[model samples]
Target: MDRRFNKHEKLKSKKLINKLFTEGQTVSAYPLRLVYLPTSLNEANTPVKTGVSVSKRYFKKAVQRIRIKRLMREAYRLNKSTYFNNLTTPHAFMILYIGNKKPTYLQMEQAMNKLFNKFINATHKATSDEKNT
Candidate 1:
């Protein structure tokens, strides 16, 4: 599976982002919350497109917020293929840093693994339920 997080995989559309907050469901792992919406994306080459967000209210500095976002992106980049390689559905994800304190890269990476695991289980269960119904 491809491990690189290229520009095509970065979520940037404003209207889609707004719809995501309104219609998306979330899977949370403490400091990291993954808000995801399954949708047909404009770019057919990418199965998932994601954006990272760190709250200014919590970080209080652009530098701090930027660092957190970087950590989040790195964590996602490493963990993406492990859980999503078989994903037939495309998704848009907003990964929000919901913690008040600064996090180490190690912490972020571990949380990201847990987050993706939880996401896979949740999506699988949802599909199974739909089939059962």
Candidate 2:
């Protein structure tokens, strides 16, 4: 697997970001809130871009914040392909960590996958409802 996620793959549109936070479906798992946008550009060359962050308010120690950010990035990298394959359309996301303590790499990845699946299911349900309406 290519370890690089290019610029286009990253979700960078301000409008999309606003929509994601305001109108997008959100799924939470203790340390993570998976906020996703459902529209995407459908092209094979488009690479997925991702951004990782740790809140300093929750983690005062710089070391702790860095470690959590690293773990989050690794988790996203590993499970990203799964997310890519599962995309119903082009989507944007931010995986915010809400837990107090940092978790192991495996733990983060598992949480990510679980949260993503939930997000996808929610998206599907919403779409179905819209179709019926």
Prediction 2 global C-alpha lDDT: 0.73
Best by the TM-score measure: 1
TM-scores for all predictions: 0.97, 0.78
On lDDT, the candidate that comes out on top is 1
Question: On residues 1-133, what C-alpha lDDT tens digit does candidate 1 reach at each position?
Answer: 5899999999999998999999999999989999999999988778998999998888898999999999999889988888888998999999999999999999999999999999999999999999999
lDDT of 2 by residue, 1-133 (tens): 3555656666666777777789866788778887765665555555343556678888999999889988887777777776666555566677788887779988898888888778767878888999999
Candidate 1 structure, TM-score to reference: 0.97
Local lDDT at 4 for model 2: 58
- What is the C-alpha RMSD, rounded to one decimal, of candidate 1? 0.8
Error of 2 at 23 (Å): 3.2
Q: How accurate is candidate 1 locally (lDDT)?
A: 0.93
What are the runs in model 1 whose C-alpha is more than 4 Å off?
none
RMSD of each candidate relative to the true structure: 0.8, 2.8
